[model samples]
Target: MDTVIVSSQYQIVIPQEIRESMGIVSGQKIQMIAYRNRIELIPLKPIAQMRGFLKGIETEVVREGDRV
Candidate 1:
């Protein structure tokens, strides 16, 4: 696991390797979530960039005859 130290100013610098692998660029918006006892950071992408993300997923589902 990667470790980071929180600065006195309550800021932490992301490591270089992690930043490069995650494609995290400066000024990019990230969502922070506090779940249980740990924090999670999720990169936020623009809506336009999210286009076709769900392509090729199965959309058909079997339904009861009455429902169908």
Candidate 2:
């Protein structure tokens, strides 16, 4: 696992390997969430870039007779 240290200004630098693998570029927006005991950083992508992200997701759902 990769580890990072928080700077005195309360900022942290993402390692080079992780940045490249995640396609994170300069000035890209990232959403930070504090969940349970750890923090999560999610890269935000533009709507145009999110096209067909769920191309193969299962769409079948079992429904009750009345609902169907």
Candidate 3:
């Protein structure tokens, strides 16, 4: 795990390696969530970029006779 130090202003810069790997760029919006005891950052992707992300996934599901 990469360790980061929070500045006096309570701001921490994401590491270069992690940013490059995750395609994070300057001015890109990221969501911060406080879950349990840790903080999570989620990248907000555009709708166009999210298209076809689940292509070719399994679609079959068991159903009851009445439901079918």
Candidate 4:
């Protein structure tokens, strides 16, 4: 485990080991998710990384109306 110190402005540098292992380059976008007492960081890749993900797929969530 690595220990990181948060600066006065509340910013911490990610460890070199984790960054290199995860291939986290500069200008990479990250998504922050908060669940209960834990926080998750998900890396968001470029649009090119999402090619062929939605071929002939239904992009809708069918909902029933007039529920009791």
Candidate 5:
């Protein structure tokens, strides 16, 4: 496990090994999600990454086979 030290200035440097493994690049957007007792940092996924991902997930079908 890797740990980061919080400096008195309230700044932290993420460990290089962790950063490389997670493929986190400079200036990439991240999402901060708060769990019950912990915070999770998730990489922000653009809508383009979701292509064909949710094709089968069913939502309400509106006006099914509309009658002319």
Candidate 6:
């Protein structure tokens, strides 16, 4: 795991290797969530860019007769 130091202003810069691997560009918006005792950052992509993200997923789950 990579370690980062928080600056005096409570801001931490993401490492360059991680940023490049995750395609995190400057000005890209990230969603931060405080879960339990850790923080999670999720990259937000535009709607147009999110198209077909779930393509070819399994959709054959059995359902109740009345659920449909």
What TM-score do all the candidates reach, one by one? 0.89, 0.82, 0.85, 0.65, 0.57, 0.81
Q: Give the TM-score of candidate 3.
A: 0.85
Query: 1 or 5, which is superior by lDDT?
Result: 1
For model 3, the superposed segments whose C-alpha errors exceed 4 Å read none
lDDT of each: 0.93, 0.96, 0.93, 0.86, 0.80, 0.95
Each prediction's total of clashing residue pairs, residues at least 3 apart in sequence or on different chains, is: 0, 0, 0, 0, 0, 0
Model 6, stretches more than 4 Å misplaced? 65-68
User: Is candidate 2 or 3 superior in TM-score?
Assistant: 3
Best by lDDT: 2
Off by over 4 Å in 4: 52-68
lDDT of 3 by residue, 13-66 (tens): 999999999899999889999999999998788889999999999999999989
lDDT of 1: 0.93
For model 6, where is the 10-residue window of minimal lDDT?
A: 41-50
**Greater-TM-score candidate between 1 and 6:** 1
TM-score of candidate 1 relative to the true fold: 0.89
The regions of model 5 sitting more than 4 angstroms off are 49-68
Best by TM-score: 1
- Looking at model 1, the pairs that clash are none
What is candidate 2's lDDT per residue for 1-68, written digit by digit as tens?
Answer: 88899989999999999999999999999999999999999999999999999999999998998994
Q: By the lDDT metric, which is better: model 3 or model 5? A: 3
Cα lDDT of model 1 by residue, 7-67, tens digit: 9999999999999999999999999999999899998988999999999999999999899
Inter-residue clash pairs, candidate 6: none
> Which residue pairs of candidate 4 clash?
none
Candidate 6 lDDT by residue in tens digits, 1-68: 79999999999999999999999999999999999999999989989999999999999999999998
Rate residue 40 of model 3 by lDDT.
98
Could you tell me the lDDT of residue 19 within candidate 1?
90
24 in model 3: Cα distance from truth in Å? 0.6
